[model samples]
Target: MIERTVKYKKPSPKPEKNRDVRLPRLYKSLYDQIINNHYKNALKTVNKLQRLDTDNEELIKTRIFILLQLDQFSHASSLIQSSSQPFAYEHAYTNYRLKNEHLASQSISPDSDDRKWKILSAQLLYRQGDYKSAIDLYESLMSDLSPDTDEYTDLETNLKASKECLDFHRHGYLQAMDELNVPPLDVLENNPAPFPDNYKPPAIDTSSVTVSSATTETPSKLLKQKEKRRAAMHSKHANKNMQIDPERWLPMKERSYYRKPRQQMSINHKRR
Candidate 1:
């Protein structure tokens, strides 16, 4: 048996690492756009990044964030749904923005440590007329948040608003208004008068009224009116003739009104 030499084939370099070389540059551009509040441009960059790395969870999150910044809650919600990674806070927030209270409440993780989730929960409670719960959440947030920050200030305002809403709902002010038979300001503004839909205005009886001879126009009065109209026409024609100027239709600069003193006819021409 003759021994045959077996040649080994060299392995080719993987192109996967080379293809990712542009990813960092794209990421930097995306971050720059986001930082400058250019969400529309950031969204475009995010799309390009997604195409390059379809399975990147961070890219999906970034794209969803950009969509939210652009107020595209529907698109963000759909993206969240299609994504395998769970975006509990984003999903809840998108549902909240969309006014889907049930979905928002269901998706929100109340026990999460994220402050934004708590704020969203409080807002949802307030929307649901649970002002007491909202107030409690806002108070807790106020205690934890630093007083110097804008978030703390906003929370303070929300807490006060929640307290006011709670007081309005719990107090007898609405009952008093109802007892007094007074409509709310919104009702008064929207419908100033509660006229019946089927009600019709009374018809005027013109047949019963007669035109008196004194109010009727006589032949002499008709002649006088004709004379006045003739006089008006004559006066109008006279005024038109008097005001007529040959240069009236000319360009402003070429008109007599704009003529130079030296360009105007001299005293000899005027005399002629």
Candidate 2:
């Protein structure tokens, strides 16, 4: 019988999937840092994660959020601008914060799933003083968005603020001043006639106009007569302000006034 050489086939080694195990732990660290408001630390870890998976959408978004939290608005804007594909929310939001409204509107893709883009767009309109457009958008969003959510709260706040602004624009400062029973700002802005023609302020009796004794004197007067008297008290008592102790004030010889020299101890004295 011819002995057939049985070639032993070595088992194929397991695929190098250990990298997958580290993914969640790394993400957890990122999450923890963010939740604890360790934005700078979170940003460092996020950069590391992005390096491992350069195309990670979530990592990119988190990095943008971290930059925003750290108040690095320009950096966030640059990162969005450098993206290979448009991330509508990030791009629009960063541009919005940068006050680049036109660019933000351009960056907003109509097909984007993020409703935040629409919210940002509406907020841009609100900020640009376009209240009607903003209110319409916000009202529509309010209908669809739940009131308990932050987005809804923001929408409601912006809507209310926009309405107020709208009212102000409609009625104007003069009308508002009249409604609130306050003087109009224009009255302060315009130069008053030095004196009305042939009209003079009535002469007042200076002797009868007494200076107010209260601390709430008009700013034109630095100090009333009573205030001057009170302020002068400090200078008046300056000599008496010294902290001389009564017991220590007794007369003594000049030499006794100084501390006595420490007595020299006799180190070699025999016990007596």
Candidate 3:
């Protein structure tokens, strides 16, 4: 019997892919640990995991999400921005930058995507003079709201507002045209009033009227008395006239005293 050298062959080492495939399960366990508020353990596990699976996507995503939960936005932003797989938050954040339909002050424009990315890249179509596009975009977005309507982007609602705004502007224009088409208040401009050819004012008859420089004679006694009466009547009317009421009187004795007549003049002739 030839003693065939039974060289014990060691099975080839398992492939890197097979080793990498195991990392996610352990990574997820570590994630759960952190999720349970096991910060120290989670950190320790993540450190061990990083050494074990240097570039695992789940590990990275979890790390960044944890950092974000810790309110470390800047660091989270950095990590997420540098992720290998595309992150929804990155997309959401890009939208945050570019502004969604909502126009929140804090949002910025992000990179573009397929039909979404308002926060990052989509602009108000109407603002860009693309009303039809804006309307279409809004309508399309509305159709997707069976479950998550509350999560509608600022962009979608803005598009709706833009549509309403467009209608309002159109209404204003129509009103303006209607006003223009209506007849003017006064159509006749600068037209002189008509004067008939036969129109004539009555002729004045002043043949007996004469202007005089001096009085011809002194008035008779009765005429002078009438003239004095007329003068007195005119003086009575010359004061600012107002209605007098009996109720306005202070008292009977006071009124009688106020109404006392003036004393009559007594003339004395000299008996020389």
Candidate 4:
């Protein structure tokens, strides 16, 4: 009878939903840090989670939260490859990634508020050199063109670019004709002097209007950057004109290899 006797072990109490032994108190601490706006501290907690876990929703969620806060759209997109919950953080991150890839990519659900970040992502996508994507996003919001009007503005910009390309390509043949010293027959018959050899348009001293990309650069603050750039450009250009003598033009707004033409104002910053 004594040999048959056995002892039973009691089961452990269940941990809370937001916290558990598996997740650890560290996550709770991270949450507190997040609430306190201590993002750096929260990031440390996330790092600890990464070291221990292999693949888990909680860890993914933690990473997502951190990435979104830091605006690491590309990083967050990679972490959450595929998830079932559409409304989950992973879904949002996935949409964000897709949007960045192409503004018109159908990442958001049907009933999404395009005005919400869902639309902003499109602008960003274009700004980042994804023209095709940016165009797509603008097309979808044809109805919501009233409020932000970003869609309309962006659309007009894209249209102008398209027209410019068409014009350039269509007239490209003229350059070759002119280069071969082959003027149209009508001109040759009517005028005694054929087009002058080494004949060139008076170096078409065009005052090109620069179109700068609203850059995501060393912005003191995101909202104020554009305003500041505009103000500075105006001042520089005006001052340059006001001075008795203007030196070289200020730095031009350079665009990435593939993107919209960055318009810059040739502002003279030198004082009169």
Candidate 5:
């Protein structure tokens, strides 16, 4: 035995917890994009993070939400199905957005302690046209969420939309006009001008509105795309209106299948 005691190999020390191989800056950027409603950019960041932290539950949830926001429902649905362990709320939400209501209801955890699941349930109810149920659920859930949180803000917004949808479903456009004490545009356009001859609407003051350098400069690619969408929508709407035979309103019996309602026409006109 030339050397009975061989040199022992020392084990390497574990890296510090804070020194984990995660792109914290990129994660923060993803969060910032989500908060700013930049879902397209957020989706891109999610792919980057997945390369590093594939098992992060929050990232998976966020990626599903971003996909939904981007109207990539097929991708969202596939993601939900493929995820090893999807969050109940996110799974329910993605299913709801994909119009799989039955599946969405099944995914919801009745015993879930998370307030976000309740919010998703309410949202599903709203989408199902159960506005009253959604409203009640929202009211109940409101007590659990802090008013300062973004979740609460979103809940409030959904509540408002549910109420609006309920009202629209219950009351016809004519009834809404009566309730609001506003003249319907078709009536106004068909009849004489409400104001006296030579009466002009007051000119809006443009002095208070100053165009910033950013506004004057060429728009960003994203903004330009948005503008293009708006332009296309405006053009399509204009073409539809031009094709409408204002002189002959479609018969009530045929309206459901063949004609767009006068109220819709008025609404579209106002959108211009």
Candidate 6:
């Protein structure tokens, strides 16, 4: 019997396990940090994540958000500006925080339908003293939001403030004063007299007028009398004792002179 050479096929090597196991752990760490409002720690974790996943656009945005949370608006703005992708809202928000209204307005698109973008736009309008536009935007947002939510409460407050500002601009006391040509006290004092230069006042006769005794007294005499009266008043009240509670209006616990009684400490011993 001719022995047929049975060539055993080489077994395929087991598929290599993924070597980069730190990616998932880093992601979890970053998420936990962000959730706990630990932006400083989150920033470090995000840097690691960015290194591991260099192509992730979301990671870049997350870093910008972390910077914002840390109140590093300048850094966030620079990062956004340097990024290849457009982050209009984030860029605008950073500019807004930096008080660069012109740059913020230019960066934000007017036609964008994003709610946050709209809210930022409204805030920009409010800052620009465009109360009517801000009020309209706030009112529209309020209608869409439930009253129980915090966002709705904030919108309501903003709406009220904007309405008050609008009213003040349209018919406020200051505006009324301006319309009536009421000069400020300082301006009135500085300007020429309201009467014409040619006008003159009639002379009055002083011989018939009778002066009061108090008015006729010399200033030195008057001052001496006042000092004498003050001395007598002080002497009258000098011996009076303070009988009423000095802190009568204050609560018992809030009184500075009041102290809480100390409790006696008792130790319990256990028998072995």
Best by the lDDT measure: 6
- In candidate 5, stretches whose alpha carbon ends up further than 4 angstroms from where it belongs are 1-38, 52-62, 143-272
Candidate 3 structure quality by residue, lDDT tens digits, 25-121 = 7668786887698765676677677778786667777676566556555666666667767676453553343434354223433344555455223
lDDT of 2 by residue, 157-241 (tens): 8899999999888877767566785456797579564776889788988998767666666655754766887877777547666
Which runs of model 6 end up more than 4 angstroms from their true locations? 1-19, 176-272
After superposition of all CA atoms, the RMSD between model 4 and the true structure is 31.2
Off by over 4 Å in 3: 1-48, 65-73, 80-92, 95-132, 147-272
Q: What would the per-residue lDDT of candidate 6 be over residues 1-272, giving only the tens digit for each residue?
A: 98879988999998854538878888989889999999999999988788778989999999999999999998998899899988878988988999999999998888888899889999999999999999999988888888999999988888998998988888777866768967689988999878888889998999998888998889999999999988877666565575777889999989999766544222222221
What is the Å distance of residue 22 in model 6 from its true position? 1.5
Model 3: lDDT equals 0.61
Give the candidate order by descending TM-score.
Answer: 1, 6, 2, 5, 4, 3
- Candidate 4 vs candidate 5: the lDDT winner is 5
Name model 2 segments beyond 4 Å from true.
1-25, 50-58, 109-114, 172-272
* lDDT score, candidate 5: 0.81
**Residue by residue across 226-249, what tens digits does model 1's lDDT show?**
889888776553664476688878
Model 4 residue runs over 4 Å out of place are: 1-24, 47-56, 82-99, 114-118, 121-272
Q: Between prediction 2 and prediction 3, which has the larger lDDT?
A: 2
Give stretches of model 1 more than 4 Å off.
1-21, 182-272
Query: Roughly what TM-score does model 6 have, to 2 decimal places?
Result: 0.58
Q: In candidate 3, where is summed lDDT lowest over 10 consecutive residues?
A: 263-272
* 94-129: candidate 4 lDDT, tens digit per residue: 564555434334454546664655555555555455
Residue 152, model 5: Cα distance from true site in angstroms: 5.5
Task: Report lDDT per candidate.
Answer: 0.87, 0.78, 0.61, 0.61, 0.81, 0.88
